[model samples]
Target: MIEILNPAKLAQARVTGALVADILQALKSRATVGTNLLDIDRWTQTMIADAGAESCYVDYAPSFGSGPFGHYVCTAVNDAVLHGLPYDYALADGDLLTLDLAVSQGGVAADSAISFVVGESPAPESLALIDATQRALRAGIAAAGPGARTGDLSYAIGSVLSEAGYPINTEFGGHGIGSTMHQDPHISNTGRPGRGYKLRPGLLLALEPWVMEDTDELVTDADGWTLRSATGCRTAHSEHTIAITEDGAEILTLPTQDR
Candidate 1:
């Protein structure tokens, strides 16, 4: 369902978005060589509970997944991209890690993701992949505003990934997010401009641009939730929850900073 949040709801969204951002950043800082994936999940759980927020993931059973996710965060590493379920695995130096999170505060939900290298000696390719996804995410956000088409955002995102020589997989992409985690008007990583749903003020969209190094194909892990590149090539994903406004897009998921 497509829900346009009212000002009060939007206010709640901003709070939730900031919480998501803060949690992701904290997880990244704690992610180091030898850190267990389960540790990350636990950290997420603590933060969400402490903030008096609800997790959008745990107990989430979707058709594509095996069953209820039973986790608080998505910890994708190296070849893994989307829906990387936390497992009994330890991180390694130079491993490319992606953390995706969504939470609800005051009944409003916001989502965001980040890709970064864990530990020192990050491979050059890994660094490049992370950079590309970050740039694509910015481009997508820049293209969003009142009256803008969803296609415009997708096109802007795809332009960056394509130029970076990475292939985008459209099986899963961004979507509308509000009281619920995933909502209507799917936003692909690539598309034609001036097409698809028109943006409206107070609309919240999670625009994520993810790319695999070599191919656009992906395969599900035995966990039934983690999606990995078909070629086992490194991957990266970047995302942000944005609000369409009269002035432009406001990145609600940006971590709060002291002035």
Candidate 2:
């Protein structure tokens, strides 16, 4: 479903976005060496509850996933990428962790993700991979505007990943989000420009550009939710929920400090 937010609804969406961004930033700060994945999930639950918000993930039962995702947030470490289910694991130094979160506040939902190294150990390759995804996400957001087609955003994102030498996977990409966690107008990471759905004011889209270091293929972990690189290479993912407006695309998921 394609949802267009009215002015009042958009205002509520802004609040939802801000809350999501703040929570993500908080989680990033708290995640460190020895941080347990379950603990991270607990932290997320507490934050959501304290804010009087609802987790989009907790009881989410999408077709691709195993069942109801009984977690508060997605904790993707190293090879794990999308739909990462939190489990019993302690973070180690230099662990490439991706925290993807979505929350509903005031009846609106916003989704975002961030990738970072766990501790003091900085791996050049890991940093580069994460940086590439971030750069691609920026490119995608910049391409989003009134009248811009989904392909334009995809092309911009794909160019960055391709130039950076990372393989793209289209099976799972960004999508429309608002009033619900996922919606129509699928945004692929790679595509031809001037095609697909046309942008319009008040439309919300979650543009995520993710890539695996070596292969375009993915393998589902035994848990049936975590998606990993088929080649076991490191991966990175970046995402943001954006609203198409008259002036341009307003990135709702940017941190409060950045606002």
Candidate 3:
């Protein structure tokens, strides 16, 4: 469903967005070598409960997933990309970690993700992969505004990933988010411009651009949730929840310190 937030709803959305951003940032800071993936999930639950927020992922059972994903956050490391279910594994130095989170606060939901390297090691390829996704996300956001079409955002995002020599995958991408976690107006990572749903004021969209280093194909892990690169190459993902306004697109998931 395509949900247009009223003034009050938009206010609630802003609050939700802030909470999600803060939680992600906190998790990123806590992620280090030897940190267990399950620990990250537990930490997320604590923070969400403390904030009186609800997790969109917990109890979430979709057709593609195994069943009610009993987790608070998605912790994808290295080859893992989307729908990464937290497991019993400790992080290691130079591991590329992607944390995707969504939460509902004040009846509104916000979603966001971040890819970063864990520990002090910095692998050039890993950094480049993360940078590409971030750049694509920014380009997609920049192309969003009132009257803009979803294709415009996709085109902008695809250009960046293609130029960076990464293949595009449309199997899963961004979507409309509001009272619920996922909504209508599917936003693909690559598409033709001037097509698809047109943007309007008060519309909220989660634009995510993710890519695998050498392949666009994905394979589900044995867990039946985590999506990994078909070629086992490193991957990265970046996302943000944005609101279309009269002036332009307002990024609601930006860090509080950045506001």
What are the lDDT scores of the predictions, listed in order? 0.94, 0.94, 0.95
lDDT of 1 by residue, 1-259 (tens): 8999899999888899999999998998899899999999999999999999999999889999997999999999999999999999999899999999999889999999999998888899999999999999999999999889999999999999999998878889999999899998899999999999999999999999999999999999999999999999999999999998888999999988720
What lDDT score is found at residue 138 in candidate 1? 94
TM-score of each: 0.98, 0.99, 0.99
In angstroms, how far off is 56's CA in candidate 2?
0.3
Q: CA lDDT of 44 in candidate 2?
A: 98
Task: Estimate, for each residue in 1-259, the C-alpha lDDT of model 2 and write its tens digit.
Answer: 9999999989999999999999999999999899999999999999999999999999999899897999999999999999999999999999999999999999899999999999999799999999999999999999999999999999999999999998899999999988999999999999999999999999999988988888999999999899999888888999999999997899999888999
Q: Name the best candidate (by lDDT).
A: 3
lDDT of 3 by residue, 1-259 (tens): 8999999999888889999999999999999999999999999999999999999999999998997999999999999999999999999999999999999999999999999999999799999999999999999999999999999999999999999999999999999999998998999999999999999999999999999999999999999999999999999999999999987899999888878
Return the TM-score for candidate 3, rounded to 2 decimals.
0.99
lDDT agreement of model 3 with the native: 0.95
TM-score of 1: 0.98
